[model samples]
Structures are given as C-alpha cells and as structure tokens.
Target: MEIRRTPVLLSWICLLLAVFLIPGHCFYLPGVAPADFQKKDPLQVKVNKLTSTKTQLPYSYYSLPFCRPDTIVDSAENLGEVLRGDRIENSPYVFEMREPKMCQIVCKLTPNEKDAKDLKEKIEDEYHVNMILDNLPLVVPIKRLDQDSPTFYQHGYQIGVKSPHSEGKDEKYYIHNHLSFLVRYHKDEQMDVARIVGFEVKPFSVKHEADGKWNGDKTRLSTCDPHARQTVMSNDNPLEVEANKDIIFTYDVDFVESDVKWASRWDTYLLMADDQIHWFSIVNSLMIVLFLSGMVAMIMLRTLYRDISKYNQLETQEEAQEETGWKLVHGDVFRPPTNSDLLCVYVGTGVQFFGMLLVTMMFAVLGFLSPSNRGGLMTAMLLLWVFMGLFAGYSSARLYKMFKGAEWKQIALKTAFLFPAVVFVIFFVLNALIWGEKSSGAVPFTTMFALVFLWFGISVPLVFVGSYLGFKKPAVEDPVKTNKIPRQIPEQAWYMNPIFSMLIGGILPFGAVFIELFFILTSIWLNQFYYIFGFLFLVFIILIVTCAEITIVLCYFQLCSEDYLWWWRSYLTSGSSALYLFLYATFYFFTKLEITKLVSGALYFGYMLIAAYSFFVLTGTIGFYACFWFTRLIYSSVKID
Candidate 1:
C-alpha cells in the first residue's frame, strides 16, 4: 500500500506541475469562445472607460460630452470588470460587415460650462478613449522604424491634445472630433463568412462647414465630402473645445481583409518589445536559486550529517552535556514562543494567500485568464481568496492546538477575521477617497454588500467547518517533548540580533524576485498588458524556494547559538523581504511615475501597502514551515531521552 501510494502521489504532483507550467496558449478560455460573423452582419461598437496613467483613475466613457445612444444602457459586467472600473456601454457608432461608410455623423453636442471644464481636465491629464468592436479593443497603430509593419499598438487613442494656440501664447484644448476607422477582418473563402480581427483608428480634428442650411442631415459637410472622396485631414482646422461651442462628431468606417485569424487575434496585442528583458530576468533569478540550493545542500550533507552522527554516538549525559550548538536546544526547541496565537493567525493567513496565488497563477498559465477577458485575473484572485478560508482556519486551528491552546473557536475566528479585517479597512478608506473624486474606480455599495456576503455567508462558515474538523482530530505531537521550564538563551553578537538578522536574511530572497517585480509594477501602474504567466509562475516558485532556504539557514544559525525563539524569528526573517519590496515601490514611484495628483499618489501607496503586506504573509509562512520541518527532521534523527 505504501509503495502504491508513493507512486500515486508522485504522479499527481507531476500532473499538477505540468498543468501549471505548460505554455498558456495550449488551453483556451472556456466560456469566451471565438465568434464568427456572416456577410453584412451588424457589428456594434462599444466604448470602455477612459484611463490615464497620470491619474491612475478610470472614469466612465460617457462622462465627457460625447455622442451617446438613446437609451444609454450599460453592458453586462463581470465581477472582475466592475472591480477594474470598466464601464462598457453601447455607442452610437454602428457598422456593417464588409461595408464602407464615409462621413457619418454620430450626433452633435453643445457643451455647457461644466462639460467644457471636465473635457479640459481630462485632456490636460492625457486620458485615452477606449473602444471595443466585436470584443476586440480598438488600438492606435504606432509605426516603428525597425519593423516594416506597424507592429506596436497603443491600447487606446488619446481623447484630445493640449496645443498652443496660433498666437503661440496660451495653450488651447483641441478635441479629435473626426475618427477614421480601419476594421480588419479575416475572410473564409469556403463559407462566405468573415470574423473581425482588428480595430484601428486614426483621429483628426476637422472643423466642418455645411454647403447649405443644415437641417440635421449628417452627410452634408464640405470638409468631409463623400462624392469626391474627400476625408478629414490632419492639416484641417482643429476643433477647439469651448463653452457653448457646437462640436460635430463624425466617423468613417473602412473594412479590409486580413490574414490574421480570429483565434490568434490577441497575439498582436500581447506582443511586447521587452521579451529579451524578461528572459534575462528569469536567468538572473535562476542563478540566485542555484546558489542558495548549493549552500543548503552543503549544510544538509556535510555539516548536518557530521553533527547528527557525533551526537547519536554519545554514551552518556556527561558526553551529551559537552556538546554545544543546536544539540543544546533539544529540550526548548519546540517550546511555544511568546504570542504564539498571533503567530498562528499570521501563518494561517499566509497559507490562504499562498493557495489563492498558486491557483490563480495555475489558471493564468493555462490561459483561462487571458488578456482578452478583461478583469478575469482580478476576479479569479478575489474568488480564490474567499474559498481558501478553509485552509486558513485549518492551519491556524491545528497550530493553536499544537501550542496547547484550548480555545479553538477563538483561534479560528482570529484566523478568519484578523488579516482580512485589516485589509478591508484599508480598502474601504481607499474606496472612500475614490468616491470623493467621483471616479468609477470606487467600489459601489452593491458590490461592497456582495463582498460582505461572500465573507460572512460563504467564507466565514467554511472556515468554521474547517476549524471544527481540525480541532476534532488529535493534536500533532512534537517530535521531542518540550521541557516545562524553558532553557536560558545565550547572549549573541550584534549581528545576530533579531532585527539585524531578519534584515540580512531577507536580502537574498528580495534579490531573487526584484527583477520580475519591476514588470508587475509596470503592468499595474503604467497600464500595460502582462500575459507572461509562464515566467511569473517560475519566478513564484523560485521566490518560495529562496524564502524557505534562507529562513532555514538563519534558523539553524540561531538554534546553534542556543536561541529557541525560532517561531517568530523564522517568520519575520523571510517576511522582511516585504519591507524591501515596499521600499522599492517607493523608489519606483519617485523615479518612474509622473503622477502629480495627491489622491493618485495616495492610491498608489495604499494599494502597494496591501501588496507588500500580502507578500510578508506568504514569505513568512513559507519560512516558518521550512524551519519547522528542518528542526523536526534533525532532532528526530538522534536519541533524545
């Protein structure tokens, strides 16, 4: 039975690794399948939220004085989309498959003082107008000198530009009133059908003049003459947005056949120019892992083996008394440390975070959370975190029981509420700030209620069930009995002080992951696509190994010095990496970002603080477990009577 179980476990482990580590393109998203269209089918264009890197706040698409549909109905949003501040809605711009339309008007708008002020503010902030057609996001193609084709695509076009007036004095706001769209489609020769593959737009500011008295006819403009094939040109008079000015919104749609297929349409959007840099980051991380692995192997094979062998050969207590180092702490090594309850709660929360991240990454690497499915990643993370409450409760309850604590319910409640409550408070504060800005990034009351429901209704009950099950089982027995009277710890060198050693122990783990951390920050703050889940999963594994190994090494050194307070030290030692992560984020903020708004700055730091706290929990938990296993294996190998 043991032999069969060993093979079965190994097979399962291998299968799990394969599922997580495989290339993302191998598997497709389940519900978001590809769409095919027949000839002349109406393709509706939808507008998404307006985003700006400068502000880091997304606003509703129709918040500005733009053309709107009659009903102005919002598109159905998933949890992820809502959280991401995506307010997708139907636009007045309509299209037909394989058909060309020229100089079609999309409603004219007369701006009020408030509208003008809002448009000027958005233009000054450099917000982009995001649009979607057939689920493909519209992009502004940027030409590159190195490439013959326009491979680099900006996610969205700038709403308008702030240019100096003709007097070359004060700057004036110019809105791009005319949009020339090029819709690329893949045609099927056999079935006489086509699929929309690309949506590109070239924006212009054309001041139109009517040939005759305008009676609300859309196609009666001299500047955009349809008969002679005249179109909006960049050199045309720019449309300066001012209060009470009538702004005519016009668009042209041109369809073109493309070789790119619907299945691989997102390939172009996901192609980044920093592929080589990502590879270099992976190599650097691997080198750090290899170095740490070598050090750990030496400690395990040479030093640990010799010490265990000599200790086991002792004939009497006198001989054992002469022995120094880790052997001296056998009686007190497993002793519960001060504030063990808090430690248990932290470890349990870390377990929950670890499970959530691991599962989310697995799904991401398997292509279930693709870039095309906006907000899918955030939604998956949130749902997974809620479900992982079970692990949190079980781990905390088990640890508390082992520490000889009888109040299982109290420990379970702490495990479920402590970390989450802190995070929730911080999130709520940040949401309030966003609400003050009147930004769509703020969480709605309905969503907040739903979150509370998930916590209390589902997660809290699941945690209680797990804790009950954990407490019902027999408590885990320590390998060696802990003495009733604690042993006195010896004075150590200044370098071995808890704070100093923890700071030192965290350096290597931070070094291993800082490279990848750059790209993650860029993706979040700079609004770039981050689909390199395969590299991310590898880095995550490396980060885990580095954290564990470093903590084990530091714990061994501390134990050899007759210090038995390994419980919290092991956690803080690896967890200190989060301190460095937060510091690096601060540095990134000052040097890389150009954010000027106070609220935007606050938002960045607030979100980063949450991220750093999560990192601390995850790394600290890994270290505690590694050191626990190390101490147990070492002490159990010798006679301890």
Candidate 2:
C-alpha cells in the first residue's frame, strides 16, 4: 500500500511538469505531425526598399507606383499600422519577387502623340530641347520607410527609351535596361543562388564586341548622354528623357541565401550618414557651449562679485548704496506676475513636455523604442505624456495658488485640456485630409476614439487628483517681503531691450542644435533611419544647459539695468530658441527639400509649428526656473531696508 501511494505522488508531479512544458511549447506536439511541416511554405516575398542610382538615396517603393485610389480593395488604416513601417500595401505592384523568367508586365509606358504634343505646347517657348512639368515623366517618384527596407537596398529599373544613337545608319536602336546579377554562396544553408542587385545603365560584352554575347569585363553597351553630363541636377532629381519616348519597363529577379540577416542589410549606409552628421553636430555644439560658458562665468565671477562687495561695504560702513540697480526693484521682482495664472499653466505644460522628452529619450537610448519596433517610440511617448499629466497639473496649481489665488479649479482645467485639445483638433483635421486621400498613413476612426477615451478617462482624472493635492497646501512662503507700493523701473539701454536681448540669447541656443536639426529633418521627411538616440540625448542635455545659462546671464543684465519686467522676458529669452528653429526649418524647406505639392508644403509648415510651440514650452520653463533660483539667492543674501 505504501509503495502504491508513493508512485501516485510521483505520477502527479510528472503530470504537472508536462502541463507547464506543453503550454509554453504551443502544445503542437500532439496535433502537428512531422509530415505537416513539409507542406508549409518555405519563404515569403516582402516589399523592399526603393532607391535611385544617381543619388544613392532610398525611397518608398509605393510612392513611385501610382495606383488609382478607387481601385484599392481595402481601407481603414491606423497610425499604429503606419508606425509599424512595414510595406502596408498587399498589391504586387509595390513588391513581388520570384524567378526572373516568371516576371509579369505591370505597367506600359506607351507615348500618346496627342498628349505629348499638348505637353509640348504648354511649355513656355523656352528655346531648346523640350522640358515639361515632369508630373508624368517617364521616371517614377518614390518615398521609403525607416524599417522594412529590402536586401542590399540598391536600385534597379528597366525602362526602354529610344536611343538617339543608331546601330547602323537607318537601323535605329532603343536603349535597353538590364538587371545586374550577383552570385552569392550560403555557408550555413549549404546552397548557392544568384540575385538581381541593381539596374545596369549600360550592358556590354567582354567576349569581343562583334560576338554580341555576355562578358565579365564591365563596359557600357549604350551611348552616354552628353547633354546630361553637361548639366547639373540635384541629388535624387527626377529623370527627364527626350520627350515623346515610349519607355517600356521590365523586371528581372533573383535571390541568394546568406548569413547576413535583413536587419543588418542597410547598416552600412545608416552608419556612414550618422558618423558624418554626428561629428559636425558635436563640433558646432562645442562652440556654442564655449560661448555660453564664457558669458555665465563673467557674470558669476566679475559682475556679481563687484556688486555684492559694494553693497556689503556700504551696509557696515554706515553708508547707503545708491538705489540704481537690480536691488532697487526687489519690491516688484516677486510681485505676482500679470497673468500669473496663465504663466503657471505654461510652466506646467512645459514641465510636462520636458518630462515626456527626457523619458522618451531615455527609453530610446535603452533600445526599448526603435524604428523597427513600429510605433514603439510614439506609443511610448503618448503613454508617458498621459501619465505625466499629473505633474503638469500639480506644477500649475501649486504656482497659481502660491500667487495668493483661489482658482485651483480653473488652473486644473486649463492645465488638463488647453494645449492637448488644440493639438488633437489639428491632428484630427490632418487625419481627415489623409483619409480623404485614402492614404495608408491615416489613423482609423476606432483608434482616434480610443485615444480620446484615454485622454478624458485617464489623463484628465489624474490631473484633477494632482490639483487637489497641490491646493490642499497653503501658499508658498516668500524668502523676502514685498513692499506695499511697487518700485518705479529705471529707463533701460538699447542693448538691454527685451526683444534685442532675446534675439541674441535665442541665436546662441539655436546655433548649438541647428546642425542636429538637419539630420532630424532628414530622418523625418526623407525617411532615413535614425538609430543614434545616444547622440540625440546628449544634444538635448546641451540645449537645456545652453538655454539655462544664456537666460540667467540675460536676466542678470536686465536686473543691472533696473528692469523688473524679467518675468516674461526671462521665459521668452530662452524660449526664443524655438522661433529660430522655425525660421531655420523654413530655410531648410526652401533649400533642402524638393517638395512641390501645395498640400505637402502646407503639411510641412503646419507640423513645424507644433514642434516649435513644444520647444518654446520646454526651454521657457528651464529659463524661468533658473532665474527664479538666481533671484532668490541674491535677494536673500542682501540687507534690504
């Protein structure tokens, strides 16, 4: 009986272990036979990258293949779907690869004589070879993604155009496109395969020209464009062949097994772009740091020392220090600012933005958020911002109440809804436009409603809770007493004018990060992968330091001029960096981008405004806090009567 009971216990233990292991292993061992594995498809074809040979730039393959919206079979795309950054289209026009001989004709570029003549007539009688609007050019325009890039990430095109060069007197020869092949050996897989790498502009033979056969020696099979070599074109510029050429495009495909994974295919290109831009950014940021540090050091060591000594000597010497500088306006410096409530709200929003930025950057550096992860960065940012709403409300409510106010409810409401509501309204409008265009980048209606629910249900309630805690306490105690009557501000010098000083301070911080701005814009509009979050995090820290130091130095100068209007001036001085950022973006748009559509231009500027406003809030808050500490330290140290 004892032996039977012991065996039963051991059997129960074995059963429990099997239960745990089966669930983790998909429980397929019982249902899936070994024969079933042989029936599954061995491989799948995915949409690869689009690239141009002339510019060596990657583009979205979908951008070039113009398919009619009415012909689309499916709809209801979401922001998360776009963020996933996969080839969203299921059509073969976007991506399809198989045996080269199995390629099918997708498009035919037959020249309509009437259409060509109409386009020629529309050309402004510019005397020379014909030039058109390029809207229906023989070549295609494309945009690509950060992730979901193709193998090798090169380019290939087989557009047949009429070659001016004749094979022999009357024998006209048309320019033909050939796909370059690469022979690859797979070590681990023990197989060999050939792949189509790119398009050959000129394919020639090495077994003697008269043989008309393939050759290993690289040579051009077609005539070079003499006029093209003479003229200069921008990088990734559109191709313009002699008008009225009927270009028939064809495809050649092949694949080779390799140890290299898909993720590392574009590593070389991204590394090169990052390395060059990172060095330039570091050098520019160092120069700005040196200038800002020099100014701050002067104020701390020379200016502040002399003023403090003079005041101290006069105090003990039974002499009165002249009331001509910053001390003269001490009575009004801490007097609650006009629109204190609004300023509180701005500061709160700034704090929230600042916190969200730091958290996002931190997550990015940790590799938790990445382009490959598809909406990981954005989803993280939105979640963080929602949770961080508590801080925004608390900061605003605490500051507002500290100003001897009783309107905690008003402060909380604005803190929770003001900027977020405005952003959502604009976002929905833009999304509506995308939906109208039937773009895959549009967010689904259900996702938008879900976002609204998160905002109102979770974020708003958290804000209210934080405000309640903040208002429960008494107004913050002042280190120095305020005079019953406000002191008169002395006339300021031209150099001390708020706007002039702001322009100077703003330029310095902007200069520190402007080089970085170029790379960021390239990553966004150009769809290049940005994996250098470590460098970005460093730049962010430098920007904060530059803003704080510059604003503190400027605030000191304003006080020296007996100006007590430093409340708004202090915030705007550092916050002015955003204005320069916007101006620089406009400059970049006109000079760097080839965007021609009116809607694209509008979208570019519209999104830039949102970025600038967020920057203003972030930098402005930094400046305000630094000045606040500086004022408290100086006033508390002095013997004010």
Clashes of each: 0, 4
lDDT of 1 by residue, 442-511 (tens): 9999999988998988788878877888888899888898888988888898988999999998898899
Clashes of 2: 4
Q: How accurate locally, in lDDT, is each candidate?
A: 0.86, 0.58
Candidate 1 — which residues are off by over 4 angstroms? 1-27, 145-150, 164-169, 227-231, 316-318
TM-score of 2: 0.69
Pairs in steric clash, model 2: 59-143, 59-144, 60-143, 60-144
Deviating ranges (above 4 Å) for candidate 2: 1-41, 47-80, 83-252, 257-266
TM-score of each: 0.94, 0.69
**TM-score for model 1?**
0.94
Error of 2 at 203 (Å): 15
Which number leads on lDDT? 1
lDDT of 1: 0.86
Estimate the lDDT of model 2: 0.58
Clashing pairs in 1: none
